[model samples]
Target: MTILKNRLFWPAAILVALLIVNAFTSNQFVTVRDGHLFGSLIDILRGSAPLVLVALGMTLVIATGGIDLSVGSVMAISGAVACLLISDLGNQNSVGSVLLIIVIAIAVSLLAGLWNGALVALVGIQPIIATLILMVAGRGIAQLITDGQIINVQSGPYATIATGFFLALPVAFLIAVAAVVLITLLTRRTALGLLLESVGGSPTASRLAGIRSRRITTMVYVVSGGFAGLAGLIYSANIKSADSISAGNLIELDAILAVVIGGTALIGGRFSIAGTVLGAVLIQALGVTVVAVGVPPEATLLFKAVVVVALCLSQSAAFREKVFGRFTSTRTEAIA
Candidate 1:
């Protein structure tokens, strides 16, 4: 009974509720045909890949009591860099060019991250203020790379990163899964996860305990930026164009919202990559539902915002305590 009433139970229940609603409202919501799933089900996972990747990164940053407002812009920069390289090379089939471009893109993103980390970690700048500089400047760099115009590159290998699939699931989804797994191993399998949470939960205590909190904080942002860069490449590959103006616009909001909805406290400490993935899928599903039902496309954004608000409210401290407090068992209470 105590386990059933744990704080995470309600969020899990709400996730199931959304899934049930989706199934009932759309005839094709859960259909599996010819070894492929279609309708809202496919749309959710497909749309969520970038968000999942970004959210995984966000979880780490938030865990260290920092935020990377520049992720979306970094994504744009990464995409622009990748597309320009492919366009300059004149073909995606040029394996040498492809490899070189990816390396350059990753390097650029890491450099941006290093700058952010230096500002926050060494110069003692506030996370918001430091990243805000790049958030504004990064997009300008992306536009400059594209010569202030969208660049289109039609390449099978490039498009395959986004639009292609393996074993009927999206390649993007697979990549997101792999990223989550790797990060989980890095944090959970090592001492890093606990140390990060310790730092976030109480920085002074962690520092007194001999944790190198500053270094960990810096690393979080760099990893976050790298993930954002990867998302940019996937997104650009999907669309086959690098649109500086619109690619990844407001995606930071989506990622932060997903992180919050995943039951990860925005104030920092605990992180859950699996929960973030679920939250990403749920938001994406809501968008698909709005579209498949013939509602105005613009309304989808508004609905997504509403979902975020509701999820946040339900996952708030007061709600969790009130709804889940009563089922505590004597044995568990004693253990606590």
Candidate 2:
């Protein structure tokens, strides 16, 4: 009963059901080849890695009663910077140089994050409005970096960041997992999580309690940017090019959905890292399952939304009680 009551129960059940359906479509869906785990499941993990990073960051920002609409733009900017720099590298294959380029790209993303933080925390602007500015301008900035062209690069070391496997698993998946562990430790194993929840619950109350809410809020935005930057690199690496215009397009919406499905309320306060990870995977699984089942492209989103809505409804205790309470009452009346 306790396990059924858990918020993650429905989401997990839905994911398992999807996989079971996928297994019926093709035995290869869940099969491992030659002692190596290579299947649709693995592909979902690899493809969802970018969203996992973005959603993790989104979880942090939303936990502070804030939102980051600029993460998608940050992703674009980060990819543009990395690919533009990599394309100029004389060797284009030096592992060290690619690493440095990755660092610089992330640095730019940090600055973009700082910009959002400053606007929201320092200027007292609404989080949505503040981040929206960057959500619009950041794309232009990316375009400027790539001069409106898709910059392509050929770097074996860089390409491997997304495609390579370690221990028979994708490097991207491993990176996403590492990020989850790192953030879990950062927020849960320390006072930071409490502080963030406090601020999210009520900033004014947190201030009265002597917590530096502004600093915490600003810091989360910065972290969100950093994560988006990392995701950008992985995305560009997977494609071997940086598309300033199309990169990270509409990704912010997906990240927000992932966080919400993970049981993090949009109004803020309280978060679940593990749940977010599961939600990200579920989102990816839904996409793969829909395609595999041969759903029409035009109706794919509608079908997905219906499924997600059902899952969300399943998590609502009040809704369940309301719908089932009358039946139980009827039975009691008969007994009486």
Candidate 3:
């Protein structure tokens, strides 16, 4: 009964329902071909990888009572850095060049993360405002790096990061899974998760208790930035080009939505990485469902909006109490 009452329950149920619906609507929704999983389900996992990464980072930030609106822009910047580096290399296909490019992009992202952390922690700026500064300027910075042009690179290994298969699964999906597992271990297996929740729940009280709220808050933003950068790499690899304008556009919203749907409160405190992963998967599934059910491309966003509203409402305790409370009371009375 307690498990059923958990915040994750409704979201998980909705996700399962969506999968069933997809299976019924599409004959090939789940299929195995040539010893590789090939279906709308696999497609959803592959497509959702970047969003999952972003949401994972968002989860940590939100757990610390902060938000990162600059994730999308960070994605753009990282992708631009990587693709530009690869383009400038004498041999774009050289394995060493691709490896160096990846390292440079990730390094730049970490620096951006450090900058965001400094503003929020050292300057005492609100998280939203602090991140917004980067959010607004980061894309322009990316355009400057790319010289207002899309950067194209032709490298099999680089392309494989997004499109290749590893052990019969998409590399992108594997990356997401690995991230989830790594974060889960880091948060659950140590005291970090509890300390973060303490700071988010009440900074003053945590500070009095000897918790370094400032440092914890800054770390979350840094983690968020790093995740966004990795997501950028995946996005760029998918299209074989980094278009500064289009890369990771509006992705921050999706990541936040995923975190919310995963049962994380905006006010901060408790967080569930598993729940966030499920939420990302659900969002991806919803997009795939719209197309599979023959919804017009023009109305896809509307349909998604409706579904999101329904899911959020269904998960609301007040709404559930108003609708199901009376029924539960009646059942209890009858049993008594």
lDDT of each prediction vs. the true structure?
A: 0.82, 0.93, 0.91
Q: How well does model 1 score by local distance difference test?
A: 0.82
lDDT of each residue in 189-248, candidate 2, tens digit only:
999999999999999999999999999999999999999999999999999999988889
Show how many residue pairs clash in every candidate, following the order shown. Answer: 0, 0, 0
Q: Estimate each model's TM-score.
A: 0.88, 0.96, 0.95
Candidate 2 residues lying further than 4 Å off, grouped into runs, are: 30-36, 330-336
* True-structure lDDT of candidate 2: 0.93
The candidate maximizing lDDT is 2
Rank by TM-score, highest first.
2, 3, 1
Ranking by lDDT: 2, 3, 1
Tens digit of lDDT per residue, candidate 1, span 94-174?
A: 767776787789789888888888898889999999999999999999999999999998767778778777887878888
